[model samples]
Target: MNYFFVINARKFKQYLFIALAIIFSAAIVYSEQSNVSVFMNSEPSAIYSVQTEKKVIALTFDISWGDTRAEPILKILKDNDVKDATFFLSSPWSKSHPDIVSHIKSYGFEIGSHGNKFDNYSDLSDEEIRNEISTAHGILTELIGKEPNLIRLPNGDFDKRVLRIADDLGYSVIQWDTDSQDWLNKGVDTLVNRVVSKAHPGDIVLLHASDSSQQTHEALPDIIQQLRAKGYQFVSVSELIKQTQVETTPVEDQAMKQIH
Candidate 1:
């Protein structure tokens, strides 16, 4: 055997041990997100919900253009003792209301990025999208003192490129299975039913903490109780995403995930 190709017995055993260690470490990381290995596309797809059999769901609030309802909504969630909900904050909003931003964090509610400006993501070029997300992620992390790995696009508008860019930047795109339509000033009852009727285990329900969704405040109590009555467990969006490994595209979210 050529000397250069020869493997000493002790060195071969050492190499084998290192190879097994690396494989074990990879398994641990992959296990946390197993669905990624089998189902997620290379470009990454939005996670509308998890695939867990557990009767757990997530309630997410978008805080993009308005702060009029911030305190009130926080009070409502606090009163209900529902602190696990996710709040996606726009950089502009968080900049203006750092105190309120801090308050949300103090409650131990999960916070995610909502982009810096509420731009129509589908209309943005790749660089524009990067600017929007990077700007927001920086501001959020500054206030949060921790990196937030989840993002809900402004107006819920996104495309494959946006998802791919977000994946590259280390963010998982979040969407909702049940939208309250509260942004439309939909009546309280309408908002309530829109969510309660369509909700399922692993569902992500989108609401708003901004003034855009005035009816959300009115409809929230009922939404919480009714879903609870049905045996649904509330979780943060991060927790919801963490529950599943590979995310599959849902039939309905495909139609207008860009339209909010």
Candidate 2:
């Protein structure tokens, strides 16, 4: 009779359930945090910038639409003695201007893929994105004789799927940390200032080499000078990637060994 009066089975069950729920929620939170830390630390393919103390910056030009400024841009880069500036080329532009393609390589510039055409890849499916990248990859490989390990999506538009497909195809998706806003037809001074102010160590600066950006050529010289003045060394995208070397087997190029 005494023992029967003391026990409340239902109450005990409710307390146990609440305790389990608290533990489970805490476990989920911890798991998510751990995943985030890993992703931040180890994602080698899709990199915006490397975390480094050295003042190294990459200047990139997208040359997808027109070739009018191609030689001019190359001349500007040469005049600045800027080596390893990356040029991402669209399939149509690359195919149509074979001489310019040769010029880019001959001038010792790094060539990258700008997709098959100027396509906004934000909404494309994996297969479609793969097709776009693969076609461009094939073309650029043929043109440059080096399978491009890097790609810059058209219009700077990309989704998670775009990055996944790019990785599967042995390409790192490149996005710039410093955009010149030259595409917006901003004036030369404004464009130069945008890059100079936003640039930092391990930054990838975006400028256009196509006729679409009317003032990039004018702005580039100043941008280069100011960046050098600020003590930032200009590097190609490949050289920039070397800072965070996590060795990856990029899909297409067995001949060209790459460190991620």
Candidate 3:
């Protein structure tokens, strides 16, 4: 009487298997939805540095406006036999000093765009941002005979909108992991120390080839020497990025990955 209706063992197992399959399928669907949400709401990012274990670094110079500073830096690089560097050249500066730009090209260093103006792209209207990058691209392409696809925004400043606009214009926005702070006109020792102390694998070291960075040329030799001693090999920004894996998370949404 207690088990008037006997249950078949095979039927019970089949039912249990069906229920578990449904739950697993539901979990998968929920997970996919969560991923979609994160992707949709996340902000854009620039390539600040890459992830790699190789002893490689990228030395980048930004020349926004200057005639006096770039040549000395180029000379030091040449004298030191450091050919793997990148210079982000602004349109105005490139126009006024085409000869210096030509020298940079002749030295076999890489060239990237520093945009058309020294103003912050984050503060510009979307249309203005596009114009600045495109105009610089046009000028540099004419001057260098090929379009520079890499850019470092004026002052390394950008927001989500600026990043999106740059990407639309076919630019890979480059930023720095190790800032030399040479623009402060700090002493040669300070500039050298800042860069050498923080240098690491896959680092993009920021040095300036503008008039404001009075001591960068002075410090370049030592920076190169110390980094080389540490077994770091210099490469252009493109080469550095190519050899390493990259992560592109916005500054604000960096914590989004911690959520379930």
Best by TM-score: 3
Candidate 2, 195-249: lDDT as tens digits: 9999988888888888888988888889989989989899898898888643322
User: Native-vs-model 3 lDDT?
Assistant: 0.85
Question: Candidate 2's C-alpha lDDT?
Answer: 0.80
Q: Candidate 3, which segments miss by more than 4 Å at Cα?
A: 1-44, 251-260
lDDT of every predicted structure (CA atoms) = 0.83, 0.80, 0.85
Off by over 4 Å in 1: 1-41, 250-260
TM-scores for all candidates: the values are 0.80, 0.79, 0.85
When sorted by TM-score, best at the front, the candidate numbers are 3, 1, 2
Could you tell me which residue pairs clash in candidate 3?
A: none
Model 1 over residues 1-260: C-alpha lDDT tens digits? 66645667668989999999999999988886776556444547778877888889899988876668888888888888786999999999999999999999999999999998777777788899998999998999999899999999887887777887898899988888887778888598888888999998888988888876777888888888898899988888777777775455733323234444
Candidate 1 displacement at residue 221 in angstroms? 1.0
Compose the digit string of candidate 3's lDDT tens values, residues 158-239: 7777877888888888888888888887799998999999998999988888887788888999999999999999999999
Better of 1 and 3 by TM-score: 3
Candidate 1 structure lDDT: 0.83
**Tell me, what's the RMSD of every candidate?**
10.6, 7.5, 5.2
Backbone collision count in every prediction? 5, 1, 0
